[model samples]
Target chain A: MSDTARDRILERLRNAPRQEAPRPDAPASTAADPDRGARVGRLKSLLEAMRTEVHVLPAAEWIPRLREVLQARAIKTLLYAPETGLGAALAEARQQDAAGLPELVAYSETVESFKERIFAVDAAVTTAAGAVADTGALILRPTRAEPRLMSLVPPVHIAVLAAEAIHPSLSEAMQDGRWSADMPTNLLLISGPSKTADIELTLAFGVHGPKELIVFILDD
Target chain B: MANEPFENNVDRALADAQLRKNFAFAMGNFILKRRAVFSDAEQTERLRTIGHAIKQRALSRLPELLEQLEAACTRNGIRVHWAETTAVGNRIVLEIIESHAAARVVKGKSMVSEEMHLNAFLANHGIEAIETDLGEFIIQLNGETPSHIIVPAIHKNKAQIAQIFHEKVAGAPYTEEVAELNAIARNTLRRKFYEAGIGLSGVNFAVAETGTLCLVENEGNGRMCTTVPPVHIAVMGLEKVVERLEDLPPLLRLLTGSATGQLVTTYVNLITSPRREGEKDGPQEVHLVILDNGRSRIYQDPQLRQTLQCVRCGTCLNHCPVYTRIGGHAYGFVYPGPIGKILTPQVEGLEKAGTLAFASSLCGACEEVCPVKIPIPALLRRLRDESYSSAPESSVPGRGCKQNWAERLAWKGWAFLNTHPRLNRLTTALLGLVGDYLPPAGPLERWMRYRSEPKFAPRSLHRRIREEGIADE
Candidate 1:
């Protein structure tokens, strides 16, 4: 019956004499110099306008600076997936700071076992696959190592990205990288903190996703 | 309710001072926010033009593109279904959940599902479908139809929401604080997200080129609906599909900018398929249901088909003078405002929704802000023409007192008298004497109900010009 319905609907469409409107050519992504500080400045300004906290630092300050934010916010029991390289670096950073900072928790073998912990964790940190400079959005491709929840379920999301990974637009990011070749199961473009103005047209933050999206732009 | 006749709804809406205040406040902010997003006029225009072209091309080649979409989705291991009517769509959804024997389903805001009334159908078959979007959740709790497309609970203020939450949800307290109200909803829905076996979402843009379903949202409940559950189902109108992935950028850019006046929403999920091999999470089973309730009939007409270009931004509602004045509830349909005036008649029988055509002031505010540039006022006029035509089969709604023989004869009589100069002069002289004294009970009274009709002059402009030989001067 579903097949018959499909056939009938498609047939109606097929029988209608096609009035083919011309397909549009997508605008080419503007190439920007990867080393340009102007791109970061623009990205930061845009991100801040969208209510994201953009932190710029020398390569050495990356981990230490993150520790400072976590300590200042009094975030206890930070979660990270140990298998990821960023997770490993985070572990080293924790050992270096080694006191008055949050306790570090790694992903248990499965997201199911630690589901309760994930909901209760103060914050989660992950490595951003890349970002778009025009929209000031972080493009995340979730794998088991840095699962979807790390950036989503937690109240605070700390994503560290190298400066060169910032593309000028979604079009540029699509063309420059092999990101689209084998697309991940779930791909996300997060522009700012989870927010809503649904209540009396009043803008409120931290509706269901992260309240704070603090980005660490490494100058590596 | 959509089932109600429009005039009664309007009367009720007009009397409710609160509804008017809500619409005025919401529309004012919506207008300001939309303007703020498009501060760069050049960039906005470029994106709007591209968005218009993308919709035009996809709709023009709808059959081939839909076929490509199904094929691509099949290749990507997602199930796809088609529904000729809302009833059929509801049945399909029920079947999918029944196969899994899923007891409960969490749903994101999908106007298509609302059109189908899937929740009532599922409840009859003993499945609870909980709405996850906070606005939708509130509406669901109160057992009401959505008054607006984008903001389902726009009619309700924070205090009302808090009151509803207190009464409906278990062990909940009432607080007028918007943030606290939001927090309560978040905490309440979080459990449902984890427990539900099936999740439902609306498709923002279904890219035929890649078989990807792009979802745009700010509150993140859409993510929860599509992500937390083991089985995910997406429902959309057939016209929602775009031909290529590249078409998405401009459409999305304009959609967010126009809707809430944001360059991009908080989250844009590009879902290619269910969770792949060795993946930690996401829905295991993904289904896409394409519904063609009455859109194909609209598509057959070249002019009326442009109405399908609406991206559901609610910008039209914000800018429309009539919509802002009467509020969405006056439209008496799921979709309200200018787009609703054009769409309701087609989706419902023209007789049922024909009166909606008159709801618009024909101000054309809707067309100006439409990212896809659908000529809404023109379509309303077209529908009005169809409604008044003598041919019932060819007309929408098929019945109208406005177009009845008495009304036709009155106009015909007036035209005939005006065309004959001698009769025109005699009638004018008689009407100037008596037009002011016409009884308070008939056609003249009806005309005077809203505003006083200006009395005609004792002498005609034509006669004075001729008598004075003004033409020669």
Candidate 2:
């Protein structure tokens, strides 16, 4: 940074209107409450209104339910993460099934390799840390291991979000301590399937992103 | 590339029944969704006030704000470059790519890059530029310009896309199913993401306090474009600067609500600098090119300066009745609709684009939805006046002759009418007769013929009052 540029930025900051100072002593572990559940329920309703299919399951049963849904939807290959619970479930299900229902692929590998695996598959399923109840959105933090292309390249995107992740607003999500440090540098908040109404304002689905989005809400 | 005139583009769009239907359905739905989202006029008014005030504050202290952003970004290890002209901006980007000896560049949707024709410039030097935005990618493959601000391929349908994909994505079979088509593109672009050495993106807003470049998108391509590649370059118009991070919330609310009727887009990635130490994935080096182009010139004109505040939400295009009928390409520029009418002339030069200023019906819809409250209609009128005055008088063959003829005729008519009221009445009666006989010839005659003549009020009001014994005061 040049001294001139640095000085310019400092000057602008000095001129800006001051805001109420942020409270620095807030607790990191804010208690989870029953209100979180109600928010999730309302979010589920919004998803329903948009014609998206939603399912809630216990953490233990989540993997089986996801496998069933993916199989039923004819999903063949998927992008996943071990840190997210859904990744563990899919792994367990794949091991138990002698007949490979769908291949579980990780995004950290070579792009050419991932493409080859995804090209044969029907859809991609990833895990979401949370969902914004107000907007029926899922938040996914993609890191080096979880390549960003997984979410966009697939036709149908299945996001597995824990019920505990539901937040009333994006501000609350940002305030969460988990996001402040080692924040997976890239966070994606998906609302619905990728769509465009650009051609003569005509609504067209599957333009740039996933055409269909399915969210699995886990209770455990 | 088609070399068709802008009028022909409008004609082509107007003739397409399916496209018209599609635009009607989409824009109608968007308008209704916006109304629902902003149902509380009072709340909207409050938001508008905050939005306008914040932008004004930022603009008022632009130099300082830009400096603060540059400092913060530098501390975070992001390289920031400033260019006073479009040529300089393009050159900076080209030099950056050249330093890396990069050949293939993949880009996220950046209107500024399009305005500068960065892709063509890079291609001229044997560098291949690919658009990662689906709509932009489709248009690029077709060798055409973006027709819509948000949806670049808005004029193309699925069948057309399927055909384009078949021809472009080597060995891919043609399929009309939306999913199958999407899969093909996904497969094709997956390799591009990894192979491309440089990723180019557009900055939606640059925070001066944090030196953060904010990118909002639905697809994850923006993240890929900014992160997956080793080198990331962001090109932004100089006016995109904001004073602080706190001002973002309201502007984001307004932009998402107005642009897509979403509470927020799927992704609002704020990159403070290049990937920090211990970070898993992001560009190794991040460069920001601030392009002034013709913006500084626009800032010189007080009334037109407000146009710099545009966030490019594209609500103006979405709500424009004329744009809905003719799509975006008709404007013959990257921007379209009411905002385009005012901006194109100023940015591209009025000498070449003066006619676009007169395209608006001046319905004031653009001003109503503008988050920053740019009075677009008034600016357009001002441009029109400027264009008219600046036009070479000698070029107009009969300019003085026409004015002299009109002046002579008006004085003669005024003298004749003032000297003989009866003759004037006779002439008026003759006009009425002639108007009736004309059979209502287009707009001019129709306007007069449709109105009732008032029957000369049966009798003068003065005469009636006198007969009734009322005193005329």
Q: What is the TM-score of chain A alone in each candidate?
A: 0.92, 0.75
> In order, how many clashes per candidate?
2, 10
Docking class of 2: incorrect
Tens-digit per-residue lDDT, B240-319, candidate 1: 99987767778888899888888789999989898777777778899999999988877877788888888998899889
TM-score of chain B of 1: 0.94
lDDT of each: 0.84, 0.72
Task: Give the TM-score (vs. native) of candidate 2.
Answer: 0.76
**What are the candidates' C-alpha RMSDs?**
2.7, 7.4
Compare the candidates by TM-score and give the number of the best one.
1
Which residue pairs does candidate 2 place in steric collision? A8-B67, A8-B68, A9-B67, A9-B68, A12-B64, A198-B154, A199-B154, A200-B23, A201-B23, A202-B22
Q: Tens-digit lDDT track for model 2 on A95-122?
A: 8873535777665555544545554456
Candidate 2 per-residue C-alpha lDDT over B1-473 given as tens digits, one digit per residue, 9 for 90 to 100: 12566667777878988778666766677788788888889778777777777776676666667777788778778899977666877889999999999999999999999888889999998999999787788889899888767778877877888899899879889987766766676667768876789999999999887777888887556766886788999999878998766577678878888887877675677777676554445677999988776666565555566788888988888788888888777777877888788887787766566667777789999889887788888988877767545345222111122224554677788898868978866666565556445454564465566375333444444446757766666
The DockQ leader among the candidates is: 1
Q: Which ten residues in a row have the lowest lDDT in candidate 2 chain A?
A: A21-30
Model 1 residue B344 lDDT score: 85
What candidate 2 gets wrong by more than 4 Å, as runs, is: A1-34, A47-53, A58-64, A67-129, A142-164, A175-184, A193-214, A218-220, B1-26, B166-169, B172-176, B388-473
Report how far residue A79 has shifted in candidate 2, in Å. 5.4
